[model samples]
Target: MLALLGACAPRPQGLMRPVVAAEATEQGRSVDLLVATNRQVVADPDVRYGNRRDPHLHLTAVSVAMPKGRPEGTVQWPRTTPPQPQTDFHVTRLQTLTTVAQGRGWMRQHRRGGHVLLFVHGYNTTYGEAVYRFAQITADSGVEAAPVLFTWPSSGSLLGYNYDRESTLFSRTALEQTLRLLANDPSINQITILAHSMGSFLAMEALRQMSIRSGPLNPKIQNVILASPDIDIQVFARQFTEIVGPRPRFTIFVAQDDRALLLSRLIAGRVDRVGDINPAEEPYVSGLARAGIVAIDLTRIDDTGGSHHSRFADSPEIVQIIGRRLAEGQQLTTSDIERGGFVMVAAGALHTVGAVVTAPVAVLEAGSRPVPDISGTLAADPDALRTER
Candidate 1:
């Protein structure tokens, strides 16, 4: 019955009408995206990876046009056939990589100073939606890292939530494999994960599996950002604890009024979802204070449209702040602007840092690779992305 609500609006299908023309790319700049998916490829060009799940992983290099003077944090999808490149995002170039080595070669070109940003998209998303959304985030944030996307087969139906959940469960191993492949490559130095919605759950589970089965998550995965995650608190607790030591730094974006997560909580036995946690409340506030984990609350911030589920991506201020920090390889703290959430004095400057700092453990597990001068010249033009990375 809940799923029927989506049936009312009837999502725009077959919008991925790729306009692969040389002049079409000339109309606007493009964000070159590296795509990896477990969704089965379709014969129809418009709906490339519809709703079907695939057993094997597929890799593609796609260049998506980014028109100028557009509002930030919005995807200008094509409403007509063969979208206008100067305004709508249209595909210019797409080539499937047949082998892991070929995929690595694609990364090698974008690995400016050896940093890569991998994105995992969330529930009720089509393959095209994931690609375009990631492209917007990458282009808007202006993060100077290679853009790689991992997309699982989401049914893209509002009512198909059950199928989407099971698909994520089925694709965990594939995601794990993709991570391992990225970590194993020699050209890649540092890796950061950006997982949205249910993708956050998938990311956590993959890391947990690695910790248990393969001993520990690769130290190369230095940071993880979970945006509007839809994971149950109890499940997240279990998943978080199972990840082995030398864990990466984690940042989570939360909001108290996230309607999508509210619905999620109701459906999942009335359990609290992490995305809706009120930072000032109970064990969450105190626990975050103690752990020194940064949880930015967006409950008070405005401009998140619709369901309030995508505050991290929708807000320009938040995106710029996060992108700049990640690009510089810096810890997320407060600035004068404070575009993101206010860092609660959880435990006074983070759960009494002196207590954890002064512990007699000798603090030797610092495993982050030396920050190579990864700057291949930050783009002066917002539209100019170097090497499509």
Candidate 2:
């Protein structure tokens, strides 16, 4: 188990699908996506087209088709020759945007006055990994919003932690620019920021910089979701304070037994990572409530594989909930929790299974209801339902 966990570290790789001309295939429906990155072009003809360091940001449009059957929980990538019809991502078109105006114009045309979901990847991730992950996420979530990937340069090596952190810091200005461009555009109605692991640190730092330079965040950014964040609790509090305005609906997904973050904590001089917070604890719950943050504790939820750091994306039930809520532009209320059955509502805050419910609670969302049937959404492997924490 430990070996498997350690091997789960992310690394740079070639694009899952090669860039090709736009043409429909028998495999599935094609999804046109817009991507922005700061990685330098490697001048390689292969799928992995970029390297770790680039001074300027670049924009491109890509098309990712869903597998014919539209698999329920995961995005199926083609691995065989002539590619299976039901599962493959065909990179139909790729267009580079030379200027900010061109990028904004492309966004305006593609967005069609709809919402946009911006994804930021985590540590040891490469350009291709980030792009494909967002594609899978968008497809699995069933969100109508335009999908956008904001990729920063990461060394894509397990031992490149310091380099990745430096790269994240270096990319904040570019990320902030991208966000501002989307927020200020009249063609985009809303923007949702979904960040994971160390990416959350970069996302928060960029937002803090924006707040510091331009007052509060733009109103168009309606939601911010942080999953398995690799950030120090103290640093998170400081970053949280920098944003001074009516905050967006901030939601955080935490798991107490996240082994990746356990290692991160040790590396950070024993400081607690935000994603490993114990929501059942009074101080943590109260602090989240005071910050107007909704905390979802997934400690009791079983992970499908790996170190369980990416459980937010691995679990079908959680993915469905996320997709449904994002599509509806609804926050995860106490009622939603009861309906999902993945987690129990204690007091007002969402808690892991077996936590005692109390009165005068710090509820994450509004409303209350009786538990509903979640059998359909539960994982097939009963053993997978049992959590280490």
lDDT tens digits by residue: candidate 1, 73-149: 88787766667666677777788888777888899888867888899998989998898888888888889889999
Model 1 — which ten-residue stretch has the worst lDDT? 354-363
- Model 2 Cα lDDT, one tens digit per residue, 318-367: 76667668434677766555564434323222434223211112323312
What would the TM-scores of all predictions be? 0.83, 0.81
Best by lDDT: 1
User: What's the lDDT of the predicted structure labeled candidate 2?
Assistant: 0.69
**Model 2 alpha-carbon miss at residue 345, Å:** 12
lDDT of each: 0.73, 0.69
lDDT of 2 at 85: 42
